[model samples]
Target chain A: GGIITQTPKFLIGQEGQKLTLKCQQNFNHDTMYWYRQDSGKGLRLIYYSITENDLQKGDLSEGYDASREKKSSFSLTVTSAQKNEMAVFLCASSIPFSNERLFFGHGTKLSVL
Target chain B: GDSVTQTEGLVTLTKGLPVMLNCTYQTTYSPFLFWYVQHLNEAPKLLLKSSTDNKRTEHQGFYATLHKSSSSFHLQKSSVQLSDSALYFCALRNMLSGSFNKLTFGAGTRLAVCP
Candidate 1:
């Protein structure tokens, strides 16, 4: 079985600062996704990529940017951190088919000061 | 607009008790329902999923039936154990969407099982 690895288990950033989170998967999956998890809000999609160099916005992509520079890696960037903004960002990968389940990384917890 | 709703925010129960978590959804297209479970500090994993209407699908002692008419896919288990305690999320896939990767998730329900 393959694993999905997300770097920086925790992050602390100042207001208006830019922060980046990284994800790498060894499943060789064709699709990758970024999701934001907030308390009481479950998980909201931020962006997804079908393959290398492809990006698609999701329901909650307003302040985030994603890049898929390689088939095994996907990255997300927070444009400007907001004070008191604390959330967990998750990275997931899946096969090309719709019926396949996603494999997710542990997550990166972000705290903005 | 498509959305999934999980009504229970928190559920506390003793071991060996029955457990049920409610999930409902709204979508304009054909739906594929899924249940995911997340242990503390761990990533959420797929617990079960169903696409056939009115048919029950199960995995790892958890079961859910997709009801097309009611837009509900409730997760249930007859007996609960301490290991069953985790955050549960309901998700929907819009089969009619252009991209197959689009998955809309509901607010999760947290379950605590104690001895």
Candidate 2:
């Protein structure tokens, strides 16, 4: 069995600060995703990496950046934190298209002060 | 573009009563729908999934019938339990890249089963 671990379960940042959240998975899945979750707004995809060093923009990608420098890790960065970006950010991974099930992390709850 | 819709923001039910959460989706290709349940601060986990049209899939006493005709895969359970209280999300599996599978999730429905 494998687990996806997200760093800094709770993140507090100052407005305009650049904040980063990291995710690591031992599942060795090729596809990794970063999703922002908000109350009544559901989960919106931020970025996804198909393999190492590959990054693809999602529906909500304007204010964020992502890196998949290693196959076992994917990280998301909030370019300039805003109060509106305060939400639960989740990281998920899965095998490419096969079965199409996602394994998600516990999520990082962010707050901008 | 692909999208999933879960109309109810919240559903409150008494224990032992039947429950249902509606899920609908839009996709250009054949749709793959999934139900994910999140309990409080825990991570969301897969509750059920279906790809074949008109077949009902069941798990952990919950079931959903995928109807391609109407683009729906509604989750249902005969009896609700307090343990069933959770936020439920419906997702659509989308093909975005040649090597990856992308999912579009609905806003989610919070089901509160009371005693």
Candidate 3:
């Protein structure tokens, strides 16, 4: 019955411009994650937080910044949009040590011109 | 380190046929494997997951069994329908690597069921 909401479902930015995506969840989950999805590459983690105001770098964290301003919200910023980058950014959340299932939002599709 | 492999890039099958998508993983720690399905223009959702070896987990008409001996969790469904067309991803949770909520996903397999 809970849902994860991602704002700006689609974004278009010029190369070298900064872009930010927002996510909000009402599941009262303790953990949140940001992943990048490409055509053939599947999904790759960029950042995740287990609690409010905490951030952990993932394998593909470079060139991206994440913030867990509060328990209900997590934000991700693309430091600089790459010309060749056109992918989807997904937001997910879960209750640690409880249910291993993660709830996902529709995702924000990013396109760099 | 943890890794997941899905060898098929695309699978084309007609409706009413049985389907199987290969998934294998590698990890030094205990493996928590998952299968996620993403329909067109929709979010990726958890189809099923399992950490118990040799036990089969089923959901929404799809089934998978975790085999620690071979380190594989293959997704299967009998008599696939047109709605079964989508992208499937196999993921691994490397709990021992300092994070219990992080997942490493494979390249993904796209299934297209035709009439």
Candidate 4:
């Protein structure tokens, strides 16, 4: 059973500041994804990578950037934090082409001040 | 546009009672439905998935069947336990709109089991 680890479980950033969240998976899955979850709302996709060094934007990728530096790691960056913004960013990994199952990280809670 | 809808915001039940969570979806492709469970401060875990219509899929005492005709995949358990109290999310997979490995999720249902 492989695990997905996300670092800096909680983050606080000032308005207009740039923040980055990191994720690592040991599942050796070929696809990785980043999603944002707001209170009382559904999870929204931000970005995804099918393979190393590949990046694809999702429906909510306007102010976010993603990178798959290696097969085991995926990272997301918030271009500019907004005041009073609070959400949880989740990282997930899955197999190639098949939507079989996604192993998810515990999520990073972000609070912008 | 692909989307999932879980109408119940919260469900409270006594231990040993039956459990049911409603999940509905809207998608253009053949639906690939899934149920995910999330404990407090923990990552969401996959509970069950079904792409075949009218067939029930079971896991860890929970079961759900994807009904394409009605666009619904509701989760159910014969009996509820305190351990089953958690957040449940219904999801649908979509790859048609130039998106790769993307999942559309429901708002989520919080199940609280009281002993």
For each candidate, give the TM-score of chain B.
0.97, 0.95, 0.97, 0.95
Best by DockQ: 1
lDDT of 1 at B9: 99
Alpha-carbon lDDT of model 3: 0.94
Ranking by DockQ: 1, 2, 3, 4
Q: What DockQ does every candidate get?
A: 0.84, 0.79, 0.78, 0.77
What lDDT does each candidate get? 0.94, 0.92, 0.94, 0.92
TM-score of chain A of 3: 0.97
lDDT of 2 at B15: 99
What DockQ results for candidate 2? Answer: 0.79
Which DockQ-derived CAPRI band holds candidate 3?
A: medium
Runs off by more than 4 Å, candidate 4? B95-100
In angstroms, how far off is B112's CA in candidate 1? 0.7
Q: What is the lDDT of residue B51 in candidate 3?
A: 93
Error of 1 at B71 (Å): 0.8
The residue-by-residue lDDT of candidate 4 on B5-95, one tens digit each, is 8999999999999999999999887778899999999999999998888999999999998888899999999999999999999999865
> Against the true structure, what is each candidate's TM-score?
0.98, 0.96, 0.97, 0.96
Model with the higher DockQ, candidate 2 or 4? 2
Task: Give, for candidate 1 chain A, the lowest lDDT window spanning 10 residues.
Answer: A95-104
